[model samples]
Target chain A: MQGREILFIVLSLVACFAGLGVVLAKHPIKSALSLVVNMFSIAFLYFTLEANMLGITQIMVYVGAIMVLFLFVVMLLNIGSDRSGMKILDLKLVPAILIALLMFSLISFQVLYPLFGMQYPVADEGFGSPEAIGKSLFSQYVLPFEVASVLLLVGIVGAILLARRKA
Target chain B: MLEEFISNLHPVLAIFVRIICFSGIAIMFVPIQVWWERRLLGWMQDRVGPNRVGPFGLLQPVADAIKLFLKEDHVPSGVDKFIYYLAPILAFLPAFALGGTMPWAPAEGLYGLLTPVADINIGVLYVLAISSLGSYGVVLAGYAGNNKYSLLGGLRASAQLISYELAMTVSLAAIILVTGSLRMSEVVSYQTGPLWGIFPYIQNWNLLTPTGLVAGVIFFICAIAETNRAPFDLPEAESELIGGYHTEYSSFKFGLFFLSEYAARFVFSGVFATIFLGGYNMLPVRWDILAVDFPGWSEWFYFMHSANYWLSPVAFIAKCFLGFTVFVWVRATLPRLRYDQLMSIGWKSLLPAAVANFIVVAVWIMVTNLYGMIAGYASLVVSAIILLVLYLNIKAVGFNESTSTKRRIKMAKFNLKENEESN
Candidate 1:
C-alpha cells in the first residue's frame, strides 16, 4: 500500500476503536467524548478521501456544535455513573440492536457496496468545494434540502416546547 | 552563504522550520504581551502595576513562570487523577495548535513552505474546528476538579461558547460570501490594493467595507466572548467564582491555564487581523507603481515580490500587536458583564444581526452583479430601512431583556429611626 493509504487505514482503525468506546463507556460524558474522538477520526477519513469541505463541515458541525450541545446537556444533567454492563444486553435492547444491524447491512449491500452496476467514487477537480456543494444544494437537491431544513425547524420547535415549563 | 543555505533547504524540513520558528516567536511574545497588558492597563487604570521585577517589569512573566515551576504540584485527594492532569494539557495544546492553519508569510521563501504549517483547503474551517474544541479543556478541567465552582465555570463556558459560535459563524459566513473562498490566503489576497477596488488611497481591509464593517463588529464581539475576555468573562469572573474552573488547579497547571489564555488571545487577534485587517499587506496601495517609477529599486521589488515569504509576516505581526492592544484596551475599559446580560447579547442581539447582515451582503452582491452599482445602492438602502424597522419592532416587542439591575435590594424597609439610632 502507499503511504497515504496506510495512514488512512490507521485512522480508520482508530475511528472504529473510538466508536466502540462510545458504546462501551458507562459514563455518559465519557461516551460523548468517545463520540467526539469518533467524529474527529471520521473527519480525518474524509480528509483522506480528499473531501476537505466535507471533512471540515464534519468537524465544525458535529465536533464543534453538536458535541458541544451533547457535552452541555451531559454536564448539566450530571449523569450518575453506571456499572450495569448487562443492562445493555437486556431484552429491550436486543431487538433494537438487531434491527439497527440489519438496516446497516442492508444499506451496505444496496447502496454502499455498488451492487447494482454502480461505480466506485473518486474525487474530481472541485469535487468537494464549498462552491460545488452550494451549487448542487441549490440546484439539484433544492427541494429535499429545503424540506430537510423545514424538518429541522420543526424539531427545534418541538424541543423548545418540550423544554418549556407551563406558566 | 545564507541565500545558498536558504535555497538548499528541503521542502518538508522548511515547513518544520517555519512551524517551529513561528511558534517560538509567538511563544516569546506571550511574556511581552503580559508585560504590555500590565503597563498599558496600569496607565489606563491609574495604577503602577508590576514595575519591580525588571525594566518596565519585563522579567515579571519569567519570574512568574519560575515561581510556578518551583511551587510543588498538588493534587486534591477527591479529584479524578488522570483527567485532572490531562485537563491543562487539553487546554494548552489546542491553543497552540490554532497556529497550524494560520498563514503567516507568503510562499516566496525556500521550498514554498514559509507561510503556515498546514495550508489545507479548508483553512477557515480548521480554525473554527480547533477553536470549537477549546471548550473541552475547560469543561474537562471543571469536571475532573470535582468542585462545584469549577463545574459552574465549565457549564457557563460551554453555554457561552455555543451561543456565541452561532453569531461568529454567521459573521464568518458573510466574510466567506464576500471573499467567495474558504481558504485563508485567498481571503487575504482579495483584500490587496484599494478599498472595494475603486478608491486608491483607502486600504481594502474588510473593516472598511459597509457590509464588512457590520460583520467585523459582530465578529470582534463574538471573538472576545469566544476567548472569555471581558466583558464576557463569566466563566472565570474572579469576584464570583474565585479561580473558577482552575480553582483546584495549582502551580504549573494553573500556569498552563494562564499561558493558554494569553496565547489564545494573541492568536485570536492574529486571526482577526488576517481576516478583517488585511494580513501582512501594510497599505492597500499597488506596489507596481514604485517598480515602474524608479528603476533603481527593481531588484528590491523583485526580492519583495514574494511578498508573503518575508515582508508580509512582519506586517502581520504588527497588525496582530494592534489587535492585541485593542484586547487590552477593552479589558481595561469595560466591566465584566453579568451572566444573564452576556447570554442575552450572544443569543438575542448578535446572532440575529449577524444573520441579517449576511443575507443583506449576499443580496447586495447579487444585485450589484445583475443591474449595476445603482441598483446595489438602492437595494442596500431598502435593506437598511427594513433592518432599522425590524430592530425597532424587536426592541419595542421587548426582545432585548430588561437591563435594570437586580430587583431585590437588601435594605431593611426604609426605617429611618432605627438607621439613625444605629450610629
Candidate 2:
C-alpha cells in the first residue's frame, strides 16, 4: 500500500479505539474527553480525504465548541465514575450489543460496497474549497441547508424556553 | 546560504526544518515578551520591575526558567494525576501550534524560504479551531487540580472562551467577506490593494476601512478576552480564585502555564497584525502604486517597494512585538472586569456589534457588485442607520424599563429584609 493509504489506516485505527474509549470509559469527564479524541481523529480522517473545509469545521464545531460545553457541564456537575460493575451478560447488554452489531455491519456493507472493484473518482479542481462548497450548497442543496438551519434555530429557541425560569 | 540550504533539502525535510526554525524563533520571543511586559508594566505603574536580574532585567525570564527547572515538582494528593500532568503540555502545545498557520512573510522570493509551516487554505478557521483548543488546557487543569477554586476557574474559562469565540468569529467573518478567501495569505494580499479601493497611493489595511475598523476593534477585544488578559480575566482573577486553574500547580508545570500565556499573547498579537495591520508591510503606503503613478521617481519607489517586500519577515516580527506592546498597554490601562460584566460585554455588546458589522459588510459587497461604488456606499450608510435605529428601539423596549423595574423590586425587597432584621 501507498504511504497515504497506510497513514489513513493508522488514523482510522486510532479513531476506532477512541470511539471505544468514549463508550467504555467509566467517568463522565473521561468519556467526554475520549469523545473529543474520537472527534479529533475523525477530523484527521476528513483531512486525509482532502475535505479540508469539512475537517476544520469538524474540529471547530464538534471538538472545539460542543465537546467543551459537554466538558463544562460534566465538570460543573462533579460527576463520579460508575462503580456498579454490571455483568457483560446482563439482559440489557444482549439487545444493545445485537443492535450495535447490526448497525455496524449495515454501515460497513454500504461503505465497502462502492469500493469492491471500482477505483475512487478523482476530485475536481478546488472540489473541497469554501467557494465550491458554498456554490454547491446555494445552487443544489440550498433547500436542505436552509431547512437544517431553521431546524437548528427552532431547537435553540425551544432550549431557551425550557431553560427559562418562570416568574 | 539559508535559501540554498532550504531548497537543497528534501521537501519533507525542508518542511520540518521550516517548522522547527519558525517555532524556535516564536518560542524565543516569549522570554523577550515576558521581560518587555514586566518593564513596561513597571514603567506604567511607577515602579521598577525585575531590573536586578539582567541588564534591564533582559535575562529575568532566563533566571525564572532556571528557577522553575531546579524547583522540586510537587503533586498534591487527591488530584487527577494523569490530567494534572497532561494539562500544562496541553496548554503549551496549542499556544505554540497557533504559529503554524501564521504567515511571517509572503510566499515569494528570499524571505519566503522558511515560515508559515502549514499555509493551509482555511488559515483563519484553523486559528479559531486551535484557539478554541487552548481553553481545554485551562479547563482540564482546573478539573484535575481537584480544588473548588480550580473548578470555578475552569468553568469560567470555558464559558468565556465559548462566548468570545462567537464575537471573534463574526468579526472575522466581515474580513472574510471583504477578502472573499479563507486563506491568510489572501487576506494579506487583499490588504495590499489601493486604500479604500479609491486612493492609489496608500495600502488598504483592514483597520483603515469603516467596517474593518469595527471588526478590528471587536476582534482585538475578543482576542484580549480569549487570551484571558486583564479587564476580561475573570477566569484567573488572582484576587478571587487564587491563581485559578493553576492554583494546584507548582514548579515547571506552573512555569509551563506562565510560558503558554505569554506565548499565546505573542501569537495572537501576530495574528492581529496579519489580519488588521496589513501583514508585514512597513508602512501603509503603496510604493508600487507610487512607482506606477510617478515614473520620474520610479527607481526610488521600486527600491522602497523591494525593501518593504524582502524585509517582510522582520516587519512582521516588529508588528507582532508592537501588537504585544498594545496588549500590555491594555492590561496596564484597564481594571479586571467583574464576572457578570465580562459575560455581558462578550455576549451583549461585542457579539451584536460584530454581527452588525458582518451584515453591513455583506450588504456593501453585494451592492458594490450589483450597481457601483457610490451606490454601495449609499446602501452602507442606509443599512447602518437602519441597524442603529433598530438597535436603539430594541434596547429601549427590551432593556431600559424592565431592568429598572427589576432593580426597584430588588431594592424594595432588600429594604424589607433590613426592616425585619431591625425589628
Candidate 3:
C-alpha cells in the first residue's frame, strides 16, 4: 500500500532469491558470490530499517572483506571441478530437514503466542541514526564494544598465524 | 515549461550532472592520458609513437578502444568462469565509488552548491576503505584464472598492497592530526589563512609545514605503489610472471581491468590534490582576496561569481589532470624496481619514514602547545632534523648491497643448473 512497505517487500524477495542461489549454485565460487548478494540485500534491508551504520558495516565487513577471503580459500583449493556426479536423497538429509522445520515451527509459535503477553517495541524516530547508535554503544554497551574489539583482534592474529606458511 | 521542469527536477538533474561530469571527464582523460604517456615515452626514447593513427596519434585511443571491443572474448577452460567474469567489474567499481567522496571544490556562496556527490563526514576514511577493496579484484583474478603465474601475481599483489597500506594509514593519521577532522572540506578549510601552526608562528598548510610535507610525500609514494604503477608493478611484470593476474582475460573483461588502472590513477591524483594541493582553492589566498573584493567588484564579480560556479568543476578536473600528468611523468622516468627492492622500500624505508614523521609531528604538536613557543618554526626545524637523520641512516645502511649479493647467488644457482643440463 505504501512506498516503504513495497521497498521492504522487494528487498526481502531479493534476499530470499540470493539465499536460495547460495544453496543451489553448483560451483563453490558461485555459491560464495550468491552469499555476497544475500549479504548485500540484507544490508539494504538494514538501510530501509534506518540502521545506516550497521547496513554499511555489514556490506563493508562481510561482503567486501570476509567474502573475498572465503572466495580466496575456495579458489586456492581448486574446487571448481567438484560440482558434478552426486545426487543423493539421504536419510541424513531427512533429519536436517526435520530439525529446520521444528525450529521454524517453534519460532512461529513463540511469535504468535507470547507467554508473557508482552509486545515488541514500535519503531521510534531516530531509532537507527548515527547519534542514537553512538549514544547506545558508548553508554549502554561499552563493555560489549571493548570486548568485541579484543575478540576481533584475537581472531585477526589467529588468522595471520594460520595463513603464514611454516618458515 | 522548461524553467518549471528544471526547477522541479533539480535534485535528480544534479545527480545526473555529477554522473555525466565525473564519468565524462574520466573517460576523456583516459584516452588523453594514454596518448600523453605514449608521446612522452616516445620523446624520452627518441622515437615517433603512433604517427599514422591520425595527427600524431591523437585518435589512437579511439582506434585502440574499437580494436579491443572487436577482439574475441576468450574464456579459458578450467577457469572459475563466473569469478573470472566478475573480476573486472569488481576492479572497476571501487575506482568509480572512490570519486563520490572526494570534495572537488568549495561550496558556492548563498546558493550553496558543493562539489562531490555527498559530503559524507568520513570522506578520507571512506576513500581509504574503498581503495583497499581494490585488492579483491586482483586476488580474485589471480585465483580464478587457474594459472600458477596468475596465482603468484595475485598473492604478491595482495601482500604488497597490505604492507603498503599500513604506512599509508599512518601517513594519513599525520594529516588527520593537523586537520583534526576526517572530512576533506574541513581539511581544506583548515589550510586557509596566514600559515601558522596550532601554536604561534607555525605554518598551517601540510605541503608547506615540514612534517606535513614528509607525510604528503610518503602518502604520494604509497599511493603510487598501492595502484601498482611502475617501480611497484611486480604483479604484472612481463619479465617474470608473463602477464600476471589478468593473463587469461580477453576482450572487454581485460579492457575493464585496463580502464580501472587509469581510473585509479586519476582518483589518486584527485585525492593528492584534495589533501596536499588544497582542493578548489584557486590562489593560496583566493578565498580571502575574494571576500575583500566582493563588494567593490559586485557588478563584474556577479558574472565572475556565476562563472566561479562553473569553474569549480573545471578546477577540480584541472587539478586531477595535473595529478595524472605527474603519475605519467613518473612512469616514464623511473625504471621498475626488483620485487625485493619494492618490498624493502615499503617495509624498510617508507614504513620507517612514515612512522618517524608521525612521531616527530605528534611531538611537535605537543611541545609547541606546552612551551607556547613559535610552533611553526620549531616544527619545521624538528621535521628537517628527522628527515636528515632518516636520509643519513638510509645512506649509511646501503639499501641493497647485501640483498643484491644474495640475489646474485640465487641467480647463479639457476644458471648452473641450466649449464649442467645443456652440457
Best by TM-score: 2
lDDT (tens digit, per residue) of candidate 1 on A1-167:
97788988899998999998898777787788889989999998988877888998998889888998898887788875675554855787889888999999999998978877766577688888877988999999999999999999999899889988889
- Model 2: per-residue Cα lDDT over B154-268, one tens digit each: 9999999999999999999999999988999899989999988899899999999999999999999998998888888887889999989999999999999998998898899
> What is the C-alpha DockQ of each candidate?
0.69, 0.83, 0.26
Q: Which candidate's DockQ is highest?
A: 2
Tell me the spans in candidate 3 whose CA falls farther than 4 Å from its real position: A1-7, A49-55, A77-92, A108-160, B1-7, B10-13, B109-114, B197-205, B287-310, B347-423
Expressed as tens digits, the lDDT of each residue in A19-57 for candidate 3 is 988877777777887898789889889878777667766
Candidate 3 yields a Cα-based lDDT of 0.76
Worst 10 residues of 3 chain A by lDDT: A81-90
Please state the error at residue B7 of candidate 2 in Å: 2.4
Give the Cα RMSD of candidate 2. 2.6
Quote each prediction's TM-score.
0.88, 0.94, 0.78
How many angstroms is residue B313 displaced in model 2 relative to the true structure, after the best TM-score fit? 1.4
- Model 3 clash pairs? B196-B202, B197-B202, B202-B376
DockQ agreement of candidate 3 with the native complex? 0.26
CAPRI accuracy category, model 3: acceptable
Best by lDDT: 2
lDDT of 2 at A74: 88
Which pairs of residues collide in model 1?
B105-B308, B106-B308, B106-B309
